[model samples]
Target: MSDKGLFISFEGIDGSGKSTQARLLADHLRDAGRDVILTREPGGSPGAEEIRALVLQGDPDRWSAETEILLFTAARRDHLERTIRPALAAGKVVICDRFADSTRMYQGLSRGDLRGVVDRLHDLMIGVEPDLTILIDMDPTEGLSRALSRKGAEERFEDFGEDLQKAMRAGFLALADEFADRFRVVDGARAVDDVASDVRAVADGFLPKRRV
Candidate 1:
């Protein structure tokens, strides 16, 4: 953890409601008069957003697994420089929708054998992990159903189908175990408000109280 502020990241399979939870947490923290920045990846800063469009749009196979990993790392570096790091330096609670964990799961899943490559690249370039990471766990079938209902060009990942999503879910759960110190698993199958409240409480425990 940084000495100045909280860096909380929300991580989960697509449609696990992690994105929504991240947003709600940011809002809740802001309401308590905390300095907060809500951002996301593949694109959080300008350069990252451009990279996001490239990665998330176009045909599903627009980039090969190795190339996709490189692009994601590039965007993440830009995000760390232009957005996340600076905000933390200024003593703001920075809530990121997804971080390197997504890269690990998505890219590693691509080749199954490429996970080592992904980890090595992350260590070589983007070495920082969030101070706290919330992993929203959900049933893949339900998550896929929700994900498909949303219309967007970003449907490239969703097109991978439920089996892949289930595998990803297991991967994410495994990650929570692997990085237990900084990761918390939340059941995303619950009601939104229930999940939101749980998220708020968990984050509140980690954050320092605002000064009068």
Candidate 2:
């Protein structure tokens, strides 16, 4: 590890249980006597949280793919400045629920072929990737079912329907292959504790040995 603490991100199609896994990992790390901060993307900082409302709780057609990319990038910049960077610099493990990889899929590929745009914006503004990215892979159909059952206002993306979810799952898997060094794929179709165990093991391999 660098003088800075480790950074880990959990990603998956909607309702794949990545969020639950992220929290569990944070708890586990803290129990093991490591400093940890659990945060989420598009809403980590005050400013970003406002933007998150704009982007996540509107019509599916609320913004063009390009506009959404810009919004996500702006929110991410704020999140990094206000939350992720400081935590990592202070030697606290940063566990993020979602990060730029979501942008690389949702806005980058879902609507059009704008991945290059996403990558360029990310490099220019938020030029950081998680030290470890745990992708909780799941079947898109089931994932969508789980997502819609939540009946939350943040279902704008889920409103895009099963097609988008399928695309997202494939896109996430592809990202895992593309950034294989930092990405770890874990099955998320089992019981919560079982999935959490897999996530914990994957994270444990990346985390440095705890200081005694």
Candidate 3:
């Protein structure tokens, strides 16, 4: 990790507006003259993109819980090596829409254990933890409804019933409690600008003496 760069990740269940908030934070930082790189997990690199498509679009029956976790970690490893790490090394703040936290929530909801997966990936990736992680917390049912209302299609995970989404949201909250110092939970049900302002506040607190 470069001393001059800050790594921030935005995480939440579907339709919690993580992508929007991530872009807003990156724009705020860039306008303040900080070099910024906005990216997403399960992607951000060629190899990772392929893995993303496979995981998101492939046959649901073909992927077990353990296999899903491994695939996510594999994509994350590539993303870190090819994109996130290099950007941070160059002193650019990196804003990722989702990172290792998603794996913990999604896989933990499905498989019931994420400690081994998280530990193994952290070791292999050489401690690429985010300086700040903003989780846009919301009711899973509401979030999923929003997601389905906005996007007409569903991926393998999104295809899961509402109960699964609720489980995932609970998993996220549990993980946030486990990493309270590094995680911030935002009210995702608020208006876009309100949520954006909250995100800006959290990010500005970690940035190098800047304003949003």
Candidate 4:
């Protein structure tokens, strides 16, 4: 692992398995003796988790796009203060399931064009992007099927349905060009282990040599 901290984030539309891959990468690096912190947003720290429920658990229309953007940024600020920055300061590899990219897509793509707001808020309050972002790309129809098969209170985002998901997937792909230096697009339609193997390979290339 790098002695200097590494920050990584996993991003994709719902059920693209980014979260699972984030967890697997965390575990894989830990097994090789790297210190890792695995977390997610719209929740990571305690205060952020509270905000997450407010933004993600209610009716799909509970919060307007503008209001939801504020909530997500608020949560991200708390997460950075209480969870991410501290871990990175301690030289831990911080792997987050979703970060500002979700905001860029969810609010900026599906609901409204809030990319400027998202970017400015991030620049103002949460001024750090992940060192690497793994975008798990897959067909939205398949993603929705997989997402709907699961049960969770966090289904508010999924309730937006397949059309939005497809649009969001395209939005994420487009980001590859915008953030080419930090973005890696991986096909997520494969088996879990296969995708994980690919993810591990990517992460290994990004980080320092294994120290175990």
Q: What is the lDDT of residue 198 in candidate 4?
A: 93
Per residue, candidate 3 scores C-alpha lDDT tens digits across 24-125 of: 988988898999999998899999998988887745566877878888888998898899888888889999999888887777455567667666766776
TM-score, ranked from best to worst: 2, 1, 4, 3
TM agreement with the true structure for every prediction: 0.97, 0.98, 0.92, 0.96
State the weakest 10-residue window (summed lDDT) of model 3: 150-159
Candidates by lDDT, descending order: 2, 4, 1, 3
Query: Candidate 2, TM-score vs. the true structure?
Result: 0.98
Model 2, poorest ten-residue lDDT window?
A: 1-10
lDDT of 2 by residue, 1-212 (tens): 42489999989999898999999999999998999999998889999999999999978999999999999999999999998888888999999999999999999999999999999999999889989999999999999999999999998999999999999999999999999999999999999999888888888888878667
lDDT for each of the candidates? 0.90, 0.93, 0.83, 0.91
Error of 3 at 101 (Å): 0.9
Report the C-alpha displacement of residue 111, candidate 1, in angstroms: 2.9
132-159: candidate 1 lDDT, tens digit per residue: 9999999999999999999877988888
The numbered model that scores best in TM-score is 2
> On a 0 to 100 scale, what is the lDDT of residue 47 in model 2?
99
State residue 104's C-alpha deviation in candidate 4, in Å: 0.6
Q: For model 3, what is the alpha-carbon lDDT of residue 32?
A: 80
Q: What's model 4's overall lDDT?
A: 0.91
Evaluated at residue 162, the lDDT of candidate 3 is 84
Candidate number achieving the greatest lDDT relative to the actual structure: 2
Over 4 Å off, model 3:
1-3, 152-154, 210-212
Clashes of 1: 0
